[model samples]
Target chain A: MMSNLLLLSLAVLAAAILGCLYRLLKGPTVPDRIAALDTIGVLLLSMIAVLCMLFRTTAYLDIILVIGILTFIGTTALTRYIERGVIIEDGDAEDDR
Target chain B: MIGEMAIGAVVLLGACIGAISAFGLIRLPDIYLRSHAATKSATVGVLLILAAAFLYFLLYLDHVSVKLLLGIVFVFLTAPVAGHLTGRAAYRSGVSLWKGSVRDDLKQEDSSAQGPL
Candidate 1:
């Protein structure tokens, strides 16, 4: 019973990912896509959490941290890009020839 | 028996919340509202799912997982900040609100920043 429920929820989360993908593909603006991507990242975390539970192993836990960090960096960079047209800018750009 | 049922229930609830949030993401009219659904709902759903996994390992295997604890904390700290940055960047980049919505506190604040005409 427990395993069945886990499997069912896994399927549901997968469906949720597909729904977010629709938004990713159809979003009218850049931020809309960014938002969807962020949401997808969170959902992916949930899916992995469930996966490790099903497999009953601690080994996959590291992957969760890696994904979370990557997602954070990606979202921050994307937002920075949209806000200022660049993810990184030199403080002394005026001095640089 | 009760433990297994509880874990299953938590996992299912989390998945359902995720699906609802994703549906809202697809159906909402504008980026602001879509992100509202995406960030808030999705974050809660993920937290619940992670908590369920934590409970499963603790009760079934008789083991403690510090990494899951760290993940829960990490996600709790970061998801809202990511959402806020996305919304702010959207507004700064001139993304329009849905036509039906009326409140824009940011726009008011922006106008108020200027000297009286």
Candidate 2:
């Protein structure tokens, strides 16, 4: 029964991932795409958590942490790029101020 | 048996919420509204699923999954920040809001300030 529930949840998460993928592909603007990407990341995180339960192991927890850190950095960097048209500001250029 | 049932129900509920969030992501007309759906519902859905996992291990196996706990905390911390950054970027980059939106409070405030936003 537990496995059955896990499988069902996995199916639903997969469907959700597909839906986000559609948004990612069809998004009319760059920020729209970024938002879709962020959503997909979160969905994947939940999916992995469910998979861990199904497998009856804690080994996959590290994957979850890695995904979390990567998603945050990716989203933040993309956002900064969109706002400024550049991700990295030059430190030496600001020394005159 | 009862605990197992509870866990199943919780996981199912979380999955359903996640599906709903995805539906909103696709259906919403603008990036801002899409961010709303993606951030709030998805965050809560994942959190609930993580809670279910925590409960299951704690009750059935008599062990606390620190990783699941970490995941819950991580999601809670990051999701909103991502949404905010995306929305701010969109607005700053001049992505127009949906026509049906009632106000432009940010624009109005920026215009009145006579300074860079």
Candidate 3:
């Protein structure tokens, strides 16, 4: 029963990710794409958590942390780029508006 | 037996929330509204699934999983920050709001006064 539930949840998360992927591809704006990507990251995180439970092992626990950190950084950097047109900013640059 | 069922129910609920949030992401009128669905409810869904994982290990194996606890905190803290950044980027980059959006309080605040310092 436990494995069945975990597998079901995993499937649902996968389907959700596919939905987000559609938005990522079809979004009219850069930020729209970024938001869909962010949603996908969160869905992937939950999916991994479910996978861990289904297998009854702790090995994937660190992966959960790594994926979360990467997602946050990726989203933040992308948004920064969209806002400033650069991933890193140096003071006194004229392009910053 | 009951504990396992509890975990299953929690995981099921998280899955449902994830599906709903994703649906909102695709169906919403524009970027801002999509961010609303993507970040808030998606964050909750991830949190619940992580919590369920924590419950499963704690109840079944009597092992304490620090990483799951950390993940819960990490998602809870950062998802909103990411959403806010995305929204700001979208607005500043001039992604127009849905026509049906009645008002933009951010726009009501003078753009000149809010220019980057």
Candidate 4:
């Protein structure tokens, strides 16, 4: 019974991922694509959680943490890059030749 | 019996909410509103699903999964920040608001700051 429920949840989540992918592909603006990417990351995390339950193992636990950390870092870096042309500030303005 | 039923129900509801959030992401008029759906609805959906897993591990297995708990906390903390940063970046990059938007509070503030007349 629990396995059945897991399957059902997985199906719905798969559909959600597809929707997010559509937006990611079709999003007109950079932020729109970034938002879709963020949503996709969250959905992927949830999918991993469901998979852990289905497999009845704790091994995937660390993977979840890794994904979360990567998502946070990636989103922050992308946002900074979008807002400022350069991701890292150069102390010397003439550094870039 | 009841525990299994509750878990199933919670997971189902969470998935449904997640689907709706994705729908909103595609259907919304602007990036701001799409971010609204993606951040709030999707965050709550994933949280609910995690809650279901937490309940299952605690009740059926008679053990707590520390990782699931950590995931719940991590998601709750980061989702909003991701959304906010994306929206702020979009605004600063000159993504225009929807045509029907009534007020331009940020624009007003910028103009007021520059005004010496």
Candidate 5:
């Protein structure tokens, strides 16, 4: 039963990845594409958790946590860049080149 | 036997809901509408699957798995935050709502206003 459920969840996650791919390709604006990327991150984390249970391993949880944090930071940085035209300081990029 | 059946039902239900969410994501007309379906449904689906995992470990295997529970809790807290931030960021960047969208709350914010008269 557990195995069956694990398989079902994986299939759904795959479908989500496909949906996200469509959005990433068709997104009308930069932010829309960013949202799709964020969705992909969440779906990936969920998939990892489900797979961890099926395989009886706790090791994957660490990867999920790290990926979740990194994805959040990356999305936030992208958002900052889109909204303000800059995220990090080159210091002199604000002046020339 | 009962535990096994319960796990199966929960897993299948989660999968169904997840599939529905993906369908909604594709079929919805605009980014905001698709987001509404994606965030809520996907979160629920993940919660359901995590609950199944919790039950499987606790009941069938007779093991108390702290990591599984922690993962579930982390997902519950972060999913909404991530979705909300993504939506707000999209709005802030001028991704227009669908043509017929009504009563946009974000538009009322002063900083969202455009150039001088």
Candidate 6:
């Protein structure tokens, strides 16, 4: 049986995801959108965890882990690009000119 | 018997905290402030819920559930870093701090051409 408490936690998490989406859509700055994107990553991990518990399967965990690693790298690369306009090592910032 | 009750209580508590964090994310006037609330509150809430799930799995299942705990650990390790990176990125990308924001200390560093201080 799915516990009432897990149900409530999932509900609350859903609401948080919605709030993040609002920020993503409405944010006026690039980094603001990225902040929301970071939240989405965490939220995705939690949602996967809750889903695992509900379904009693660890199968989705691999997906969660993959998503986590990928999102972390993606966000870091995007941050570097946004901050300096380049994801490469050179300080030339290919797009800065 | 008591285990079920404890699990329920923990889950409910986690949910309430998560909701509060969401509210903070929505109501906070700036990205940095919202990141503070969203990151810490959600991390704590998820950890609590993960703990309850760990206990539940231990009590009810005979299969290996250590992996679930590992997932929780991964979450704990990554969430803060992601939030920090995003917040720093926001700060660097010129997102304005709220009007009532008191700290202009970094402005001094910027005045010297320190690349946003």
Misplaced by over 4 Å in model 3 are A91-97, B108-110, B114-117
Residue B76 of model 5, lDDT score: 78
Q: How far is candidate 3 from the true structure (C-alpha RMSD, Å)?
A: 2.0
Compute DockQ for each candidate against the true complex: 0.60, 0.66, 0.76, 0.54, 0.39, 0.50
- Candidate 2 residue B48 C-alpha distance from true site, Å: 0.5
Give the candidate order by descending DockQ: 3, 2, 1, 4, 6, 5
lDDT per residue for candidate 6 within B28-67, as digits (tens), equals 8888888888779878877887777677777766555766
Please, what are the lDDT tens digits per residue for candidate 4 over residues A22-84? 999999999999998888888888888778777877778788878888888889999988887
Per-candidate TM equals 0.92, 0.93, 0.94, 0.92, 0.81, 0.85
3 versus 6: better TM-score goes to:
3
- State each model's CA lDDT, in order: 0.88, 0.88, 0.89, 0.87, 0.73, 0.75
The 10-residue segment of model 3 chain B with minimum total lDDT is B108-117
Candidate 3's residue-wise lDDT over A1-97, tens digit each?
A: 8788878888888999999999999989999999999889889988989889888899999999999999999999999988877898776776735
Judging by lDDT, tell me the better candidate of 4 and 5. 4
Whose lDDT is greatest here? 3
Give the lowest summed-lDDT range of ten residues in model 6 chain A: A88-97
- C-alpha RMSD over true interface residues, each candidate: 3.3, 2.1, 1.6, 3.5, 3.7, 2.8
Task: Provide the lowest-lDDT 10-residue window in model 2 chain B.
Answer: B108-117
A27 in model 4: Cα distance from truth in Å?
Answer: 0.4
| Clash pairs for candidate 2 | none
Residue lDDT tens for model 4, B1-117: 767877877887898899899999999999999999999999999999888877877877677888888989999999999999999998888899989788888887755775421
Q: Can you tell me which runs of candidate 4 are displaced by over 4 Å? A: A90-97, B112-117
Q: Which stretches of candidate 2 lie above 4 Å from their native place?
A: A91-97, B112-117
Q: How many clashing pairs in candidate 5?
A: 0
The collision pairs in model 3 are none
- The CAPRI classification for model 3 reads as medium
Model 2 CAPRI rating: medium
